[model samples]
Target chain A: MSMHIMSAYDEELKYLTRRISEMGGLAEQMVAESVRALVNSDLALAQKVISDDTVLDDAERQIGEKAIVTIAKRQPVAADLREIMGSIRIASDLERVGDLGKNTAKRVIAVAGSGIPRKLARGLEHLAELALVQLKEVLDVYASRSPEKANSIRERDEEIDAIYTSLFRELLTYMMEDPRNITPCTHLLFCAKNIERIGDHATNIAETIYYMATGAQPEGERPKDDNTSTLGSVND
Target chain B: MNIMSEAAVEKALDQKMNTVPYKMIGKDVSVYYGEKRALFDVNLNIRENTVTALIGPSGCGKSTFLRTLNRMNDTIENCRVTGKITLDTDDIYDPTIDVVELRARVGMVFQKPNPFPKSIYDNVSYGPRIHGLARTKADFDEIVETSLQKAGLWNEVKDRLQEPGTGLSGGQQQRLCIARAVAVSPEVILMDEPCSALDPIATAKVEELIHELRTNFTIVIVTHSMQQAARVSQRTAMFHLGNLVEENDTDKMFTNPDDQRTQDYIMGRFG
Candidate 1:
């Protein structure tokens, strides 16, 4: 870690880091709670996760403002500038993760009365577990300034995408076999996609952490196992 | 037809004079005052028609390096400079080389606006008059007007040509000094904290002038303000503890310095 001679400037940067950490923790909890709500068919917890998203949004706004103010006042260069810019970028990615969690929670509410299949819900839980681990590891990378840990998390994104792809096919198979499973399985597909997108946000944060630590973008294309194009549902 | 090897082609390209040719080259340059060494062996290349900024903490040999360009350190008693500094192909430190002519080719501005106690027109015309650059009254008038215009002070002081240069505002006085430097049509302009005494608006004006001046002359500036260096310079060199730490493109130096000492200095980490 680097420090400025001005203790107040250092304190402000520390506060900014703390705020981002808080937002990361909140985003992680929301993803877990949203997935837990879906598995247990608990509407109350899903609603709570959706309502708590505003806290992460507020934290992101605070970080953005502080970073801009610090940039304007300190005119920081090199690592200090990178640290402030990295905080702003990480907060933005975390806010989007919160939104994805909130979207998953809303899907949980949509499928509350319809009984979800144990095998399908279990698959999604596993997917969420992978995504949460990615988020947690990337956050740890940010806090510790470890490009190696960040690279490991980035490499694991393909695993989350592979799980998401397999889960997509399983849900599609279930829907085709029984039209009765269509409504609930479609909702599950969307929730699974939300979790997949959370993994993507985690990967983005990992890339940002790598840049902050090394002052260069991670070389080469990020590994991707997402084969959603085969489903004919990937617009991109 | 003979085929050139890739290495030979690259070597030829490197030797070719491009837009970024070195105007001044310092090789193994070192400075000493009395028995104490103030600067280590420093090698730097100042590109033609580009602004190169030297930045560091107090007594870090940035100013000393700046002085070495025009041999301004010669005024100091018991000061010694070793190694070579060449302007284009000519050795500037050769005993036979006229210091007056050398100073005329490489003019300097100081931290404070030290305009001569003369009228604005006289301040601008002094160099040309001494060098016999103007043959007639009209010629002297033209040199004064052109120099003032280049320094971005013609419009501000056009009507008050006879007014004492010292009576102008701090920023205007600095511009007058710059106009004085330009009067000689120097190949390079060395500014040592030219805007340090000015207010923000004046600093901005001088910075703007520096940008405009780059199209016509090579500029080397020594400044305490990193932002100013970033704003006005294409290349930046960082000095530390009498050693040249690093030099690179201005944007690269500020955003991602290769040297930890440069990073520390620019980041305000104990500089």
Candidate 2:
């Protein structure tokens, strides 16, 4: 609630917070633009999303090094220690989110010449849209330091899983309907899986924020809804 | 508070309370130096074989409370302590109790190395000799050797037992003082900023020695260094403005202290 007595120490921690916010923005942009590239078949936009991922990587590295230096110099305790540790954990998760976005962008090139059917593109769009919302909301939760918002984000994680499970079945059906759909459908399945993983990373960040604010892990395991693992049949 | 974590913490505390016995208990302790009151109604318990740290800013009664443990305050002309302090159910402040014997059982090591100008052997042997802890020369010899060993200084000082204690490095002198305290075979060892005057390496050695000594003795340390308290003590008690703020396990106290005052004080947010 109060600033540390040393102004420079406060400045160091503020720098960490500002860097995390910037990295969050970059990650969100990558997810958004990669999905847009998929819908529009824009090779240039897909390339831009891939290139932007390195920036997130750099931000994560800087945050990690700064966190270590702050620990050595300040020997912070209580909330300060938790805040730094949370920053490291969240940075790492966001970096993985960046990789997922890049992987999805690479899939865009696979399906680009194959001319994805509008219906399949729309389904992938919906899945990406849900994951992006989660990413943005979890970042907002970090900015606001609200456990309520974090819990809400966690509860909504299953929505992405549900959409992904349906998309998995839909892609399978398209491949079965016609052999020509196999090449593009397989790539789309991977893209869908990548988007689903982004949702999982968003939940990871949410859990970190909850711990940062409350100094305690969220009780019980998150109610996982990714039923795709057991979906042996589309009917299931 | 998170409900699950709170439940775990409560359960852990319940188990600790049921299992760990108190080495000393002080109840409703208040101290006065002439007309000036230095301590309020403070109640604290020292757990057996555990290192308990007393921490606070200057003039906050941390040292005063440490002194009260061995009735060191009694040496001050106008100082008067009113409380029930017990060493295993024996009232320490009772009129019939011998202050000298009480001090022997609860030995003290001060901030400065206050070893006498005598040889190192003499310094370590002084307490045991006066307390009649050993009779034969061979017995005193073994006691001196083992005391230094317990203090983690025997390897360095065994060959030079007749050398003057003050001639050793600052850290060695402090360890010598600890060796002297150990010679009395005290039940509880009280250290008041014992490493403040030593270099970092020496300070680290003393800290390491404190950790090792915990298996045998109940120690209460008064320190200005929060890191030292966090490092060496199993439990830590924070004092502020002559009042007991809170005392808890060292891990809990440093990571997530309950009182805001303790948090601010540990984090250097207190003005």
All candidates: TM-score? 0.95, 0.95
Count of steric clashes across candidates, in order: 0, 0
Model 2, range B112-215, lDDT digits (tens) per residue?
99889999999999999999999999999999999999999999988999999999999999999999999999999999999999999999999999999899
Model 1 lDDT per residue over A128-232, tens place: 999999899888888899988888888889999999999989998998999988988999999999999999999999999999888888877899999977675
lDDT of 1 by residue, B19-80 (tens): 57899999999999999999999999999999999999999999999999999999999999
| Candidate 1 residue B15 C-alpha distance from true site, Å | 13
Against the true structure, whose lDDT is highest?
1
Q: lDDT per prediction?
A: 0.92, 0.92
Clashes of 2: 0
* 10 residues in a row with least lDDT, candidate 1 chain B: B10-19
Q: State residue A173's C-alpha deviation in candidate 2, in Å.
A: 0.9
**What DockQ would candidate 2 receive versus the native complex?**
0.57
